[model samples]
Target: MTRAPAHDLNAEQAVIGAALLAPNVVAELAGTLAPADFYRPVHGRLWEALCAMQATGQPVDPIALAARLADSGDLGKVGGAPYLHTLIQSVPTAANASHYARIVADHARRRQVADLGVYIAERAGTDTDVAEIVATGRAILDQAAAGSQWSPLIPLGNRRHLPDFPGYVLPEWVANMVYGVAEFTQTPVDLAGCIALAALSTAAGGRAEVEVRGSWREPTNLFTVVVLPPGSRKSAVFAAMIGPLLTAERALVERTKPAIVEAELAARVAGKAAEKAANAAANADQSGRDTLLAEATAAAMNADAVTIPVLPQLVADDVTSEEAASLLAEQGGRLAVLSPEGGIFATIAGRYSGTPNLEVFLKGHAGDMLRVNRRSRSPEHVEHPALTLGLAVQPDVLRDIADMPGFRGKGLLARILFSLPENTVGRRKIGADPVSEQVASAYTANLGALVMTLAEWTDPAVLPLTPEANERVLDIERAVEPRLAPGGAWGHLVDWGSKYTGAVVRLAGLIHLAEHLRDGWGKPIQAETVERAGLLGDYFAAHALAAFDDMGTDKSTRYARLVLAWIERTAATTFTKRELYRGVRSQIPTAADLDPVLSLLEIHGYLRQLNAPARTGAGRPASPSFLVHPEVHGSAGTVHGLPGWASRRPA
Candidate 1:
């Protein structure tokens, strides 16, 4: 048998009457109550009018509410001013308004659950996918629970805190520079630490590989991106850390100047001799022409054999994928793209063309072979390419690149080690001490020595790990394997976590080399070095959690952030589905696209829907309006629209 939708006429009338008698009662119920909680349409409309008037600092007595309702042509619609007084008189006292409001909201949720049952019944057998139908149904129930008085919504997933950087894990010299530069720039040490690893990658990458076990080799290359907002002095930090690499690159060029000069001169002399031989062959008689032709061929072969050396380029900035690939091929299949800005993502996202080109970035990180065939350029092939990336970019760049197609699916984002350091804006010291000259010079000399020594290797040396070190790596692998499962802590980050242990092994190799410096070739990596790398690994894992969460690792979370940003920008207290669609039309194309996004916001205490206006004999019902949470306006200490970890910033 059919029954009326769940509602309490007395409770709804009493709640409204209590608010009319005592205006301050509305403020206590701002976030928890919405007009839609009232069962009757007219009562819901009256509640909305009361909240709106109180929000503008107007009185909410019978006379004021009557005038306000009359102005909106709702006075007659809600049964005139007489009904307002009747409502005031209906409630025994205004003290129990909170209790009455909860009752009203409870009835509203009951009605929604009844409607949900009907919706599931209607969608049980249809062309729509069953999984999609189930997901939508669950979203409706979650939204209904979000509006309940007894149940408050908690954010999805485990919220983790940002861990402090393990600076001691680095070799002593590298740790000194990292600390000095961070203190000098007044930025987070995280930026300097990540860039330090990338600098080590540039020095040792492609020159060595870590043999974790038999037939399992990990390349000593890394892709690291540090995120900071503007005015954080990223350039200053980058310049301080990368200073040694630039100096070392210059020293290499200067040291190779004599060889380059000799090769160029040899090629020019051979070309001249080949020209003379050809000229003689053209002038010779038929009998002598054959012998002259042979001499000319031999001379031309000699000229071609005298190959000129290409300039050594250890670093490149602001390059497209094609340009990076070409530089790698020319530089013995090794290159590092180190930059203060993150324009490389824009290029990879197809800033030049409409289609994304991520082949080089993917293959470069994995040491996979890359064959490039461009229209007007010579064919280039890299047998084993290794590219290192060290960049400092604004926090918004992470969010922007996550939306690019195939950016995640292609494993490009997974390959990177992300660090979201605490933003230091507005808190920086006016005058901080600069890095000591002694520290600066020591860093430059040691880093330059490492780069020059590594550059001479014709074949990559396999880095051996001591028994204790190998055991430590095995322990980490065993611990990480279970977490990659769908319900584990690393479930949301399986792709990045799968490579975490490998990244630690590579870090161990770099640390071991730094410790020995001059004669690192003879040393086997120690357990202490591997332990230090593991600590650094933990630091990165915590930061990656924050970074990916900010990037909206899940599709629903990402879209929800877009919708919430719009709500904040427009200061929308109450809006219909149509209104929100128009506000975020570019990102949210149609009304249907807003379903999941709105549902997500509902789950996070951002917004709640108002009661739908009664339907007449029409094609469609009026659009449902939603009340934006008071916390969204900074009235609350933090924006509750996002998860807890998302609101946290590094101190």
Candidate 2:
């Protein structure tokens, strides 16, 4: 047997050359001609078969090559005979002959390397967590999958390093330029088709040209079109999609532009008209004011006397008809003042004295009048009242009153005034008091109660009314301050209730305080603070009642039983079993009492024993650590201490 020369046995060159030739062999040179030459699929198949035989320590066989090709299913797909012959022709070239066999061996080795599985297993005898290793491995796989090199495989002929068509750029290359420009300009390009076109045009070294033209008359059915390179079938496809869209957009702008311009012009015209009208109205108002002032002066001069009516009786009575006319004529012709409240009394000069019988005069008269009064020792007091006529009752006074800063209304002021004991005195004398000191006190208490009620409801809009209601609330605050014990009114109220009542009040207070912290102050209180404040104990009591209310019968007693057991277990940790039992039995004399508290505690997890000590004979062995579970803590997990309750607890 003749051995191949050393020059005919290079490995690296063979591998590179084979890799280069593999695609051509698969595409153009596979199976059209003879078989058995080196570069042919059959040769590669035979070499692979030989390597497989070597690995298994078996003899090389042609049947094995045929079997391998049958199994791989590549022979029919790669032009079967002609492709094999063409590939085989390349095997005898002098440059390839030296490296061919070694290259085949190297290919087998490379295939083996690629096929070898890279599995990760936890290290043996190490304390490393398997979960952590698995997590890290998954993360590595994810990162590798995200990189460009790890991509889906395409068919041999379909893969290309350059553009397939002449004068055309790859879509990805054009997209990159478009995106790069968008990024550089910092302008968003949302139209995907337009962007695609722009990218294509940019890559082709062409500009996106536009033409604008105007006519003396507005253009109708206006449109725009983007002309693309001639004979570029791909460009034509892009133009077909993007051309109409851009044309429609331009047409819409042109159509709407005239309407927008007209609207702007109309707005300016309306503004000018409004300015002229405002100036005319101003002049008219000034002229009216001057005329009214002059009329008022002439009327005052004509009246013999201007006496404001002291009371309504003065306007209600009538004296002589002729005397009434003389009184109206005496003081430069002014009319008598009218009073809605029968309080104002007045005298008319040169007519009826001491109070005129104004009932007859008031019956027939319906015109503007005036009430004049002499200044008195007390500037606020109205005295020496007389009636005058022809004085215009200007609306400015009411307008001024309405415009006054912080003037709520007369009724509101009266309500506030009547709330005071001093202001209530006059009404009390008349036996017509509507609101007394007692009523005010009740109102204050009700205000506090309402605040507590609102807190329980978790309504936030309540606090905004504080500015308006603060003064009224302050009155209640002052009255209640002396009655409140150290903690506050809320604390005193809770500590003073009966066992059942105390539980209810405390629970209600807790609900209120929780809501106040959340809605009023926008914060949550801490659990430790609640426990220290004795709120937890109250919650335990309340929760028991709530559970009882829900369960409604003895069948519902299961939760209560669980809570009691937990509490007993928990109590066993801190006190002697007898002492703990005694204290519980005293507070809860009936099984009924024990059941509810227990149920509530269990439901809330507050009564549950955690790390409880084992029971010893007659008493607990030692002080066991106590764990008060969270359910008794409520949502905010805070228990506010009642006033005087903590300090009064037995040591």
Reference-based lDDT, each prediction:
0.82, 0.29
Model 2: weakest 10-residue lDDT segment is 413-422
Query: Which candidate has the top score in lDDT?
Result: 1
Q: What is the lDDT of residue 332 in candidate 1?
A: 81
Residues 181-224 of candidate 2 have per-residue lDDT tens digits of: 32332222212223233222111110001111121111000001
| lDDT tens per residue, model 1, 451-501 | 988898857777889999999999999999998999687898999999999
Candidate 2 has an lDDT of 0.29
Candidate topping TM-score: 1
Task: For candidate 2, give the lDDT of residue 539.
Answer: 29
Give the CA lDDT, 0 to 100, for residue 532 in model 2.
25
User: How many Å off is the CA of 217 in candidate 1?
Assistant: 1.1
